[model samples]
Target: MVVLAKAELEQIALPAAQPPMADVRAVDLSAAPGPDRAAAARTLVAACEEQGFFRVTGHGVPQELVRAVEAAAAGFFALPQAEKEGATGEPVGYGCKQIGDGGDLGWIEYLLLCLTSAGTVPAASFPFSTLPCAAVCTERELLEEYAAAVRRVACGLLELMAEGLGIEPADTISRLVADAESDNMLRVNHYPPAPRPEQQAGRLLTGFGEHTDPQIISVLRSNGTTGLEIAGRDGAWASVPPDADSFFINVGDALQVLTNGRFRSVKHRVVVSSERSRVSMIFLGGPPPGARLAPLPQLLGDGGGRSRYREFTWMEYKSCSHRGRLVDDRLRPFEN
Candidate 1:
């Protein structure tokens, strides 16, 4: 790993504006492919290649829906410490699960599920406490609604990604996912106030440490707090701003391994913020189940084969996530 100087990190922490909220919506997927497609694809590629991150607005998820989920999450965190502990899971830095179920909280007190299986919290790989605010129907409804919207947006994005890669979108999608049950997740994470950044920079890190995502890409939605950081190609770190209405997308680790690094899985992390609370939902792109994961055939092109990582089940990779060993790390768990 390349250790960066504090100044370099600070430089990376600089932020750029998200695309206008009205322009790129969550529901824009409904729009037909117009001449805007070229400009949009070019812009998307620029961001991906240079920053590994960018925001999308008009994403179609109503703003009220986003607020409702945030509000419900806040209400849950507002509960008494004991109540919170009752629902909080796995320890911090390792991804929170339910408490006594015993892991500590990651920089978040959160819940993890999927758009496809909304409201039904199954046993996920990186364990933690179950969702504490099960009673919050508003949160569940709004969340699932947003998740569904995102699912549509993700499909559109994948198609766009396929176009960007010069192949038919369905062709790429068919090869990456398992069957019809490809993996997609929704994590509602809460990061409470924390120790000063100056202090943390010297010792322990925040909710998560720096690591690349392990999925193809992730669509993220966050509240107005800035603890997220991304690594620049120049070895700098940049702050990922909260672009209202838009979702942040970045490639994941598994994709990089499968692509033999042709597609980068940039490093990103969540940091401590003393100013206010933080919340965000990140969705990962993956295929159904045991599709022999490998480099997209498109990448192989009419060219030679380039093998980097061996094929494995998304389930197998996800399950071994908590094995406590790093040398043979393969599965791409939610948290870094």
Candidate 2:
């Protein structure tokens, strides 16, 4: 892996302004090309290639469900800090910066849960935990419903991605992510207003540091607060504003590996904005821990059939992220 110095790391962390937020492209999943799914697949290929991020509309998820989940999450976060921190579980439950070395990263709290057929796994089984607030139990039904809805959309997107790559919709990337056994999870993030909103070295203090996601794909719904940004091809950062009616799909490290870099794993971060508190939910679809991932031969483009990355399971890459720095390239260790 390439070792970056502090100055280089700081350079990578800087943010830049993008074109007007209204200019971002949106995809209609319900669009029909000759009464088939191929049209949406082709439309997404170009969009996905563009910085690995795009907005999705016509996703068929009910607005009432979205509101219900958001209300439930907000209620959970509204609890007293101590009450919110009372119940602990592995890799799931509530997390605040209070216990980690990331105190200076800015004000943020999150609830992480692993998805399963039976519903969300109990927080106790996660690798990390703080506590499950009373609201978690109260909101469990809503959370489960929300997860099912989002997971359906994610699976549809993966099918389109597979079709875009000229493979069977059910045989390619979808196969890795579309089952109950997949190690998919959802994270509900709340980024509160930071104490210092001033710029630091040309960047605002971040709620979450800049890094590419580790899953195959991530579907995000942000409340109407603007702070999400992605690193552009020019090495500058561009903010993706909150789109209430759309899901922002981000290609992750696993997809980058699967496509041999034809698509990208965008480096993104959440910066603290104005006094308005913000909420965003992310449903990350990934392969089961034991699944081996590598570039597909179909996507290698016949240049002697070489893959850009080596075969590695999601668990191997996840372990690297947990043990090493999150800002570092988690995929670098997997390159042959």
TM-score of each: 0.72, 0.85
Residues 67-110 of candidate 1: C-alpha lDDT, one tens digit per residue: 87788767766766555555433332123422212132234566
Model 2 regions more than 4 Å off:
1-23, 33-36, 98-104, 117-137, 169-171, 196-203, 302-304
> Among these predicted structures, which one has the highest lDDT?
2
Q: Candidate 2 residues 41-105, lDDT tens each?
A: 77688877877888898999999999988887787677777766763455567787432332233
lDDT values of the candidates? 0.57, 0.73
C-alpha lDDT of residue 203 in model 2:
55
Q: What RMSD does model 2 have?
A: 5.3
